[model samples]
Target: MAAPIYKVAIVGRANVGKSTLFNRLISEKKAIISDIAGTTRDRNYAVCHWRDLEFYLIDTGGMGEKSKDIINQQVSTQAIQAMAEADLILFVVDVRVGATTEDRILAKSVNRHKTPKILVINKVDNNRWRQNNDDFYRLGLENQALVSAANGVGTGDLLDQVVTALKKIKKKKSKKNGEENIRTIKVSVVGRPNVGKSSLINTILGEPRLIVSDQPHTTRDSQEIIITHNKNKIILVDTAGIRRCSKKSGDDFEKMAVEQSLENVWRSDITILVTDVSEPLTWQDKHIIDEVIQQHNGLIILANKWDLVKNKDTKEYTNYYREFFGFARWAPIVFTSTVKKLKIGELLDLLVLIYQEKHRVITDNALSKLLADTIRRHKPTKGAGTKHPYIYNLKQTRTNPPEFMIKINFKAILHESYLKFIENNMRYKFGFIGVPIKIRVAKSQNLQDK
Candidate 1:
């Protein structure tokens, strides 16, 4: 089992740069940063790896005596949960505006919980406001507020303080709850609306944890449920139904939900494309698969409602998979009915197998030799084939959407089909099932073409 990750909560009112701070600290724009208040409705979180330490940074909803939207309720609940689960809480504040009546209420709430918090004053763009943060001491968090987050002013010292706080509060061992030696695989159940996606998850989990109905797009946020199979943990993330981008229209709430589901897929290690056998592959199904490809997450296609398929075939089933999604020819396809719970355990086994393949790494010696033989068998017809078409080094630049950077000795451009051939060969040999691969060619002289 992987170690229990530390959680850092960013709690503050909406538009207080909580998301900005989370993005800045992680050195990546994982969260959507916008001028609009309540852009992040829930406690948006992303795991950050720093040196030997790994921790999750959470962005909470803005707190106040008043929040009207249904999304705000979700965010507030998530923020409260974050505080309860945090190894450390960074209470973000806006130093430029100082403190307001709402800020006072939020501060009192934090004080009531008595969670160890670091008062972080944000938007202190200049020394004037940087010095003004001292006034925020009245919030009762005497630790002092740091003027930071946007433009990263006073961030270096803030990070040092954060690391020091983390060291003090972080647990040295994994959660004993995982007392068994088992691997937990995060599986995302994804598909178009009204495809029984939520029903499938609630069925596997043996309860109606997810609010399931006949309504299309019933699930708004990605909800999680854990199931253990022979001591191995399987995390089920039941995502909202994915719709075609072209189909996506107004209703701001719906857009946010779809975005959240996509974000969930990005975090998950493997995704199960749930579809109705009656409908087979639709444009929306292809859209979700494209996203999974882009994210480089593992894929499994579940032809749901198999019980309803009157002409279920033994041979043509594979044909449908190949003809429909040419990209995921190697992905495992399971046919079952969530209503009947048929072959659900088999699906679980296949999910674990797909997850294992996702983490499989190719040895340098093996990959190098394979690349050579593949190129030889299907020699890339070089553009202006003079000069023996120089080759440089081969490096696997990315995984989880397996990609490689092939440094060519010549600056000549290579054919797209040739790159596709190389990618297909890598997939055929390595069993990169349900994942898309990219091959980028660059000119290099110093690097060896290993």
Candidate 2:
């Protein structure tokens, strides 16, 4: 049967980056950009054919955007309208700030909608960094797809997961097949109430464009400003601080702000998980990290307020995840003090490096030779005390996490420790400096039969 066209709406609290993702999805239809109704129906928003799914993209602003201080009311109305018409709603949340009463309110409201929804934990570039978000699970979303819309970082996986979710709910969609031209890094600074996330963002921007005050939850709604550094233009998202539930109405904007922050993460390639150096990594920090990993985005840990720490060990912060998430062995780490703005330039430089690492690749001969040598030296140990055979003749097929297809004996599992050794060997022979390596294993065909 021919597939029915499905509507996909990017909606969340105001400034949660629905517009940015919308522009990214329908960038080719520049002529149709409007404030009110480019995609209330199936005809608008040019689409991309992903796997077997066809999707029509729509965008909606937070409810009651008209009353907001900064955001345009008309645009907000469009966003709200788009969400109601969408088959699936991408609920974005900020991990650093944790969950707010506003989020619960939105969750309550969204739950009543009967629409298949996927909560996207955005601004999660680092899995090690989390501040708050687990409280959001009560929203009734069992599985959430994580993605960084900025670098296209787990976006493919997020899309795949979202589609899977959509299939289960039977909220089918069909989008017009076309090329999408969305490029630029959209970064949203979000964290626990008064965690200095805004101060850190303002510090990096070197501007007071985003308001900062001693007051908690000062900034409401998501505000974006674009700046160019190192020849790269990036969109900076300033969000209201997320806090525990307060007055019903007050919580609404703040929780919505958190949602917007999450959307910003989903729309961004990388996220700077801003945290106070002195404070312990709380549930909020952990929640933020969980969301970032969920989205597959790259993360850089920024220990803000470093000036407050007296003679602390830098190595601990640098190697925080060496024992935790083994996969983050190569994730870049940096320390910064918003008060002193120390190492700010170096941090940004590291960002460019982190962005570049995903694209690094080594030649095939070197990979194969290294793979063969590593396997021969430390043979794989299978379960039940069997030492499996080796992998030989590896060839580089792609870049970005540096994938390599290797011929190996399928009898054994590739041990993480052994994998690290091979990676070290590769880095030594051919400098991978900032990039992470991805190794693929394949079985050798029958020799005698051939």
Candidate 3:
């Protein structure tokens, strides 16, 4: 059995470079970083390994400032929750700014948790900034380290200390073998403002895990919840509604929320795009679909608020959207009402099916035969002043968003229509429903020799 993963939370006031440190530590730009304060309003989590020690790293929204706004309050609540759940907290502070009043308040909150913590003085890129690190010692934390998250200075020393501290916590492995074997499927609920994304998650959860309101942009952060249904573990991420920059009121917070929402789409295994059934498919909906396809993630077009649409011909609506979203014709569409809790269970069942299809593996023999038959049925047309395109061999290179490699002659003359035909035939034969497949074309060595 594998050892338990330690939970490490990066907590601090706004604009303290917590997200930068998180990206540096995880070695991935999972968290959106910006010069704007409160860029991160939700808890971003990722698993990081160092010297055989695997730990769950959580980059939380900035805290310490008191705000009467509902969104700001929720962000603070999420950060507090992350700190509480963490086995070890890295209380990040800016060395250049020194410790402000908010830092003191944040420190007190951290002390209340009584969890083992390390004082991380960030942005000590030079000797001048390093001198200011002494000011943070007054926070009364013994274990501390100075590092520059952006420049990668002194991070090794900080990680070494982190390893030493984590070694103290006893490992608690899962006893249930079946539970250990269960793979969690991450599904992000995404759409435009006030599309009932949070409400859908709450209804599906059978509880109000996320704060839902009628007000647009009520959910400023991406919140994640885990549930097990019929022996399958699923992680549901309720994200902020993405709005166009032109329509935006020029608020920095809203801009960051939009960026975070887009980031969540890439992070998830499947993206469920929720749209209001009453409204026609808007440009924002199409934009979200383009983002999902760009990320090569599984997609589901959810027509939410179905209960509100009166005397609507479901078939017409379906047909319209099917034609409107012809580019994403492979995505499954489901009509649901979070208010009525309609088709909520069916959505989960569909997710499981999509998850299986995304991970579906096809052998080289099967792919070779399918490609041969597909090319025979629809031969490639000759390009202007170029030889006819011929695919000599085909094989799947990877799965979980399957990718294929096709050895071809005259790759330059391979038209987009022919490639689309190949993809369509592959999907028809393999049933890659709700999954995007990538095909890479390469010059065949044997064809080049001939």
lDDT of each: 0.75, 0.60, 0.85
Model 2 lDDT tens row, 89-198: 77766555555666666666667767788787665556552334566687677667554444444566767876676667653344423313222455656667677776
RMSD each, Å: 8.7, 17.0, 5.7
If scored against the real structure, what TM-score would every candidate get? Answer: 0.60, 0.53, 0.73
On residues 142-176, what C-alpha lDDT tens digit does candidate 3 reach at each position?
Answer: 89999999989988888888888898888675466
Best by lDDT: 3
Tell me the deviation in Å of residue 148 in model 2: 34
Clashing pairs in 1: 13-62, 13-63, 14-62, 296-401, 392-449, 393-449
Error of 2 at 68 (Å): 18
Q: Tens digits of per-residue lDDT for model 1 on 1-450?
A: 354367778898888898888888889765666777766654556776665667777777677655565545556776888788888788888887888777888888887765567888889888777667656777888665575687888777776776677777746667667556578788788888888887887788786545555656656656666688866788888777777655556556457767878887888888898888877588788888888887878888888888888888936876887789987776778888999998888988777777666666677677788778977897665765464445554668666556678767655656667777777788778877665566778876565442
Question: What's the ranking of the predictions by lDDT, best on top?
Answer: 3, 1, 2
- The true-versus-predicted C-alpha distance at residue 74 of model 3, in Å, is 0.5
Angstrom error of the Cα, residue 284, model 3: value is: 3.4
Give residue 236's lDDT in candidate 1 (0 to 100): 82
Winner by TM-score: 3
Between prediction 1 and prediction 3, the one with superior lDDT is: 3
